[model samples]
Target: MVTIDQANQDFAQKVQSMDGGETLMLCFQCGTCTASCPSGRLTAYKTRKLIRKAQLGLEDEVLSSPDLWMCTTCYSCMERCPRGVEIVDIITLLRNLAVEKGVMSAPHKKVGEMLVKFGATVPLNSEYEDKREALGLARKPANTLGDEKALADVKKILKATGFEDLVGGN
Candidate 1:
């Protein structure tokens, strides 16, 4: 059986190599982040538990959890952490690890696909375009889909980072 000490040592070594994961060692498991997370209240997403799993080197558990994807990157947990553990940043790191392991699945991939194809996840229907015009914003050219340039840039970065496969290709 894997001992807690062994787990901690493994996790320490793994996370230490990550750029933004240095502060993970300081987490005291106070559960403040879990308590403050809006998604945790509404769903089964437990930020504290996820952190604990990561700390224990339960990489498979952390990588396979759908709860990791539910974080909206709201930064509420980061603000509430008493230990000053970069909660949101750690979550982002876990997500990147999961993507690297090819453990992340679809729906997430579909969202990326939509962003690459339409420049936004949601289509800019006539109503939203009209609303933008009504709000006195100069209407973009009708041919303009969305932030095509930005999306293209994002695709290039994702490909370089090996996220293209995580998002189910370009």
Candidate 2:
């Protein structure tokens, strides 16, 4: 039940002003994006409905929605859209906005924390290191995991992008 008073009115314009969100107002609600959404089949992610909510200025509802994070970004909806709407791009922008507002999901937050601490999403543990050694490979690959300077570089990049602040786990 979206009441008139709940509308921010400028939410749609803000979205439209975003780079990938230029096509925001072009949606005619044909439901094609929803029909073509793979995530919608397995989850409650209705791309069309979410776009409508954005158009209606339901900023809080749109940004805080778990469904907003459910997009696999496979571009299926964009491929099938009759209006050439950049649905996935808009979703990406929405996700960026959500993270900016500190509305990230727990699992995503954990991944961010891992990157901040380890410079990688999945740190190489002893078990995997042993397996790699047995296979005649280095315990850690030639990535941030294998190099302290590289890890420091990654942390620097994350900090520069404000990902550390958004993730919030030290």
Candidate 3:
């Protein structure tokens, strides 16, 4: 349980003001999000815990905790929420907030780098390329790896949006 001090007042309100976060106040701690979270079943992540932290204004804990990044954004929680809270969107918004504030973790940073480089979070390897070639498909699949212009465009977009700075990769 996180304790909020006067210094952290209105943290919940701040989060609610964010896009896709407006319905955050609708959550009544029903625990449905937790019950429905696939990540929670496999990891230490508790969707309800994150929401509770946000609702209670535990800004520092909520932003800094790695659990904030555990959500796969599959939308199962949002689908099951009784209040129609956009749980997935809220989680994604929170993650964006966390990253913008330099609260990202190392693994996530690596994936961001891969996205910037390969235009996909999961990059390709020789094994997959060989398999694709064996199947008579374009070995590099016309994506960033196979297309120079597209890769340069991805790099350009990442740079223009400051995502490279945010995730610490070029």
Candidate 4:
């Protein structure tokens, strides 16, 4: 019962509109990206597989795959790509698409929530502050946590970018 109508024609076009997606179709499944991926070494992430899914325009599979967010955006794959494909950027675009579809994993959501609430993905703690002071560094380092204004601005930027809603931030 398979038919040509099953193809996701718009998926590639939609992804192409994003920054790194432009070179998506150039991938020939050389496995270079996967071979260069450090994350793929320790995790279930497979860069080549993701590129293949994207090339095939498997929108649902690409968007829902937890592997979409496994990319560290290191650009190692892009650098190693013989075809000069922007693999990291495409992965980032995939993450954005997944968020748009409200399919973020719990760890991603928690990190986003922490960023919105504390202006840092990893909130500063008194224990860490003590360690800093012990090391002759200021207990409160120069960052968003040290300045309420900076923290507010970070929240404002997140709101302006619509990332708050994307991460289900309250």
Pick by TM-score: which candidate is best?
A: 3
C-alpha TM-scores of all predictions: 0.81, 0.86, 0.91, 0.87
Native-vs-model 1 lDDT? 0.77
lDDT of each: 0.77, 0.91, 0.85, 0.85
Residue-level lDDT of model 1, residues 63-156, one tens digit each, is 8889989898999989888888887888888888888777665777888777656656776778887888999875553432655676677667
Candidate 1 has its poorest 10 consecutive residues by lDDT at 138-147
Off by over 4 Å in 3: none
Question: How high is the lDDT of residue 102 in model 4?
Answer: 78
RMSD of 4: 2.5
lDDT of 2 by residue, 13-116 (tens): 99999999999999999999899888899988899999999999999999999989888889989999999999999999999998878788888889889999
Listing every candidate in turn, what is its Cα RMSD in Å to the true structure after a full C-alpha superposition? 3.3, 2.1, 1.7, 2.5
Model 3 lDDT tens row, 92-116: 8888888768788788889998888
Clashing pairs in 1: none
**Model 3 RMSD vs true structure:** 1.7
- Inter-residue clash pairs, candidate 4: none
Over the stretch 1-170, how does candidate 4's per-residue lDDT look in tens digits?
32335558889888887777898888888998899899999899999988887877788888988898788788888899998888888888888888778788888889998988999988899999999999999988787988888988999999999988877775
